[model samples]
Target: MSLTLEQRLDTLPAGAEVAWCGQQYVTAGQLRADVATLAGWLAAHPARHWALCLDDAYAFTVALLACGMAGCVAVLPGHRRPAGLEEQAPYIEALLVDGDWSSAVLSFPVCHWQAVMAAPLSAAPTTPWPAPLSVLMFTSGSTGVPQAILKQERELLAEVEIQAGLWADALAGAVILATVSQQHIYGLLFRILLPLRLGLPLAAATCTTPEQLQAAVRGLMRPWALISSPAFLEHLDPDLSCPGARWLVSSGGPLSASGAALSQRCLGLSPVELYGSSETGGIAWRQQHGSDWMLLPGLTLSVDAAETWWLTSPFLPAGQRWALSDRLVWQENGFRLLGRADRVIKLAEKRISLDEVERRLRAVPWIAEAAVVPLEIGGRRCLGAVLIPSAEGWRLHATLGEGRLLLQLRQALRPWLEPVALPRRLRCLSAMPVNSQGKRPYAVLKELFDVAIEC
Candidate 1:
């Protein structure tokens, strides 16, 4: 049996490299020492809950381990925006940061890792974390306010077991380089815990841009695995080449087949996309070559009357099951995702799928991109569309007024959709509002119709 992460960390060889930041390398001894010092400091100043808000992945790992050591719950927010942090401040007693906090105005006590590292180090503490030690993770549900998801120590360990075994040979001896934020669950597992447990080196800094990614890939001459998201993979420069990569993983959103093919051409391996939510750890995975997603090991899946998936997995507590948002159809070996349940809404006493509306709209000529949303106008719920038009769409919009263009779109959509499903309000924009995770910001998209628009 594999040892638990905390136990594995205690046995790691001191001289082995744990992380690389630029040209500098951090060894296991250095990491252990930092974690020890932080744990010591945290032990002295106790809190019920601490927020780990570091931007640096390496620093965040140390802080997280220290929190575990000190028996304090760490709240990992989806983003570090001042407004967001302000909302989360009530739950946290203090904040741990290694990034810029200048813009964030918080009432909670703030402590930096530098202070902890600079503090006198006590003998390394070796207390195993409690089985029920809970960590809080926030996810931006379509409703907008972040929803907190609790993850216990057991669930995390189970995930490590499943993921480590799944990619053992592919990631054996290879370092981890990631473009995704470690604050998210997927990144936390792939970029930090997996490497830490397996004793593989990880890159300290997150590659935020394509240039940084290229530089990091080139800088690490050894074989490496990349943890990324569709947002990053979809925009990969075709000319950019990194040949030594053993594997690439994407999560948080879907990657187009064309995007995956282009990435496979540039990188040596095609990206493997993992599908899951913050509430339920990783549920399934798929590669670009396949259309269906294979459930992670030890997971039992079933579909409800509405076709929504319900899963029972080791990642969940005993005798517990999770209902997923995705609608899927089971195959012999795996499942194919249809769409999200939340994307369906009721309009005029009829069920309508927002995805279906967008699909039919995109099928029309000159429509480059389409997002259909239900909006409330003068106390009535109606369909609204935000579009990114092709060159021809722009020409027509310019020739015909906005009202006329919308009428033409409605006429085109009438064949596929009922009058109630057709968009009552339409707006054209150059681009949609996308978050760092590469998902369309539905709340922001809805706001376009919420306010008065002349066009």
Candidate 2:
């Protein structure tokens, strides 16, 4: 059997220093011992399945490793609220909630993570004995309620191989520092899983602030790459100026050419983009300088009747042709992403296509980030914008839509955007919110606007 992730951990330098913040150093031996101590405690709660809410990278990584070995799935319900998601948590015996969102639900035998280490030291379960599904990510269910996607142990391994093989040269012996969360797939693969799977050193510092990102990079040595989301990348032109960073890999949303060009200008490197979904791991990818994806090696592709590309790969079960939600423009041996099939919306007898709006938004000067979401106001359709301005747009939010800027907006969009597709509600913030995977959680955005915006 292939060396399991834990067994493979032995291949790294046995006592190599792991610096999470330059303050905490745990050698490989110490890490193993810590997990043993922690897992020792977890054994006491055998009757309760864990509903985990771990946010930090190092803690999340090590804890997950321990949880997997302990056979207690550290279930991630994928919702911010506890009880709402917990009420439906499958096989949930109890909760392991974070203090900020923690509810009294823990009163019935809930164990804080600290209690886990004191339970019992069950020797690491024989490595890789068909590891159980450790992750449970929720999604928009078919009937419009949240649903969970069960991720198997081997699937995470397969993802590591696909990315490491495809981007092998960039990743060989390189360390990863990320602003994304460990609970989500994009961050899990690029930030936490890949490095651990390869036995490489990882920066424990989960850089959440722009300053933190710069600080994390400055503290690291060479061959370090930033695993970030489009929102994070779009916000930081100054932080990208750090000469220490070797490369950046951005996903979770589309990165516009302007943003990529800005990054290349500030940092010597351009952010490489990944294309994939929660369903089928990373399928194809392109660099800021490339035009189309160099599809993942060995994936089979055929066109559907509608001309969208249908794909199959060894990562998936045999003969399963995966139909993607995103449209594709297939070439003789390549393809380009056309928009997502579900992103289009209708407006006053006119269809406001996402591709059309995206192209127009990109043409606007200094419009660093834009999400043209269509929402209904009193049953009448309208558009909303959450814009991240370029440096020049720093002072304009309070003055927008009142006088000169409003005129400028109309002039900029007049020829292209149909009136109905024009943003009826314009909200500007210093930065936008991104979820675990780097995708903008639209529902969360609505919350940000709840107090300040009125349609």
Candidate 3:
């Protein structure tokens, strides 16, 4: 039987390897010692909320655990930019970071990773932590402004236990490596918490490029599992070789069929795609062979009259049912996801689904990927599209120029789309503007039409 996170923390051998950081292995003893030192410092301070902005996964884990130990709330911002961090200053009283941040830019007290670790070691505490610790994480800001979501320790542990039980066989003796940032919930759970609870050694650095992933994989001598997203998986180099790689997990957004095939061909396995949000810990997951998503254990699902999905899970507060923005088609054991309910917009008194418009645009032979956003031009609301052109599409664009290419695209969409529903402005590019989480921010997409209002 798998042990609880608290039990594992107390029982794991001190000499066991916990993480690989800065080209060296970090032992369990070091983790405990560091946590003790930091927790002591935090206990002495008066701050209630500390914002963690660390870049290294190992450092982030240490700070998080230390916050729990000291009875403090840990706040994780979605972005590392100064402006973004500044916006969170009003909510947090202190900032903990592993990178070099200037004091002139931030308003709160700053704690450097090096300085904290340099302090003398304090004895590890014997008493158990408070029953339920608190953590603050933000949404991806893909659809609108990012919103804060508060999670309790018990809720996160529940999801971790479910995942550990589901993927135990594949993860046994496998090292955890990730290309995603630990700032977000998906990476926080898969890359940090799961590995720790399962007693798996994790790589500290995030692989931001194909070369980095190849290097990390080659350096590992034992089996490894990669926690990644569609943003990094779609651009993998087919020529690169990855040995000792046993499992691949993709989340944050859906992976395309071609991207899944590429992963299977390169990594010698298909990625298990997870579907959920920060608001709801993991709801369902699917493999490349199927389109339906099976719910995780201990979760119940239902749909309302408007076809909106609702979830009841152990991860939520007792007797609370959470409404989801996603539209789904129910099956006996699982369900298929439609688009988001919020993606529907009204233009010229006609309701148009942006997802449907993007799907129609992708069906064109020339367009490879498409995103549609509501745009306001000259005080009139209309639709604008950002497209990544395929090889043939680019060739035609070069030969016939933008005007003719756009005319052909409009003709292609005319069969299924109403005149008012068609995109009023179009911008073709080589790639879509996706973040590290593999989601395109709606505000950023709206800015694509900022320069020319009438385009």
Candidate 4:
């Protein structure tokens, strides 16, 4: 019987199970039942848009799918804070939170996953319609406040073609152990949608640690595709070297050249890098160690006068020359990426803005002027800030010093840069790292940062 998504999921094979990080497993039947139960709770509130703020992947799946089934749109905001909630409240009518429910943050019904799963699957709504503009994935606010990227069912089809076909070399019987999160588009494609749509095996849990990865590999039947980022690859335990897989996939930031070489030597699979973002979804992809890509067979990219990326994609919504922030160098064969047009620095596998870092430092009150520059140390890039305070420079600088200052700054930077890129060296200076328009010149900052560290 040729069936739709709901029908296919409602009757998946009994034996096929999602290995939950090698700790446990959940069958297709259980997943369907969980979604079905939540579908009932969702039916209670109509025309309500809900958000999933919890860290758990499986709970997010159930909540999202249940909302899709009930014809209610779901807004996936990046940062779930009072500010984030305030900005996105206009799009959604309510919020959906898991276990440690925050009554202070939410004004809507806060039901546990257990409560949701126990609830009956009210009246089955009309089968999947034109997506109902259900999901609103926020653009990475690296440039500014996140913008909502509305997605329909067609996104599932788009992801399958771009990501699932290229990186995921999983055969008919093979499974995929996703290291990325499904809440984000990239993760949603590899972890949840592709597995559900194309019938590839997926790990139930989001594996982070190497021990967890080893356990996941031992448990799964096949060498799974590890969906991951450069950050995870760099810090991976050098001792634990058993990641047997068909291949691996990485995105979000550039995979370090050294790390890629190490991964191939250790894990036996060089990651396939994807060049795209939350705004335009995935555009082009290539093998980590290999050169160039097949391109997205049908698409072509061009540059405008100010030198911006203009894309023409068949998979994209009815559009042509969709302008995006990422700039590119169009080579004869494939393409080479520059970086984000914004002032953000894609360093140490994290996306952070130099300006944003400066802004945070000035808010300390004592610091009269502050500027941040991206500097490289030990073949890895790190943040370097030059501060001019009201008090004597040496007094303030000596108090924190370079070593102790790094430890102090890291605490403040947890909200900005990922662990790896926090500054190792601090310098006291009279000025910040910016031009007249308050613009940061990439070349100038890189040179000063390098010189200061060497000094």
Instruction: Return the top candidate by lDDT.
Output: 3
Lowest summed lDDT across 10 adjacent residues in model 2 is found at 138-147
Off by over 4 Å in 2: 17-19, 97-101, 104-110, 114-133, 141-143, 238-240, 306-308, 317-319, 343-455
Stretches of candidate 4 off by over 4 Å are: 1-24, 79-94, 97-111, 118-133, 167-169, 237-244, 288-290, 362-369, 388-455
Residue-by-residue lDDT tens digits, candidate 3, 1-455: 44545566667799888898867889988888787778878888899799998889999888888888888899997566565577667678998888777555578787888887887756446567754468898753334344678988878888999998989789999989999888878888999999998888999999988899888877877799999987677878888678777789998766777779889878888999998878888999988646789999999888778766799998886678888878888777688887666775545433356777887798888889999988877755788888899999899989977667767777777655657767878777787898889899878888888653232
Candidate 4 lDDT over residue span 325-384, tens digit each: 666666776877666676666764455666656766766656787767677678767777
Candidate with better TM-score, 2 vs 4: 4
In model 1, what are the clashing residue pairs, if there are any? none
Candidate 1 yields a Cα-based lDDT of: 0.79
Poorly placed runs, candidate 1 (over 4 Å) = 121-133, 142-144, 343-455
Cα-lDDT of candidate 2: 0.64
* Model 3 CA lDDT for position 368: 93
True lDDT of residue 3, candidate 3: 54
Instruction: Provide TM-scores for the models.
Output: 0.76, 0.70, 0.76, 0.80
* Model 1 agreement with the true structure over 183-286: per-residue lDDT tens digits: 87888889998998788999989887778878887888888898987767777888888778888898876677766987787786888899887778899998
Per-model CA lDDT versus the true structure = 0.79, 0.64, 0.80, 0.65
Off by over 4 Å in 3: 1-4, 102-104, 121-125, 140-145, 343-455
Cα shift from native, residue 356, model 1 (Å): 22
lDDT of 3 at 167: 95
Model 3: colliding residue pairs? none
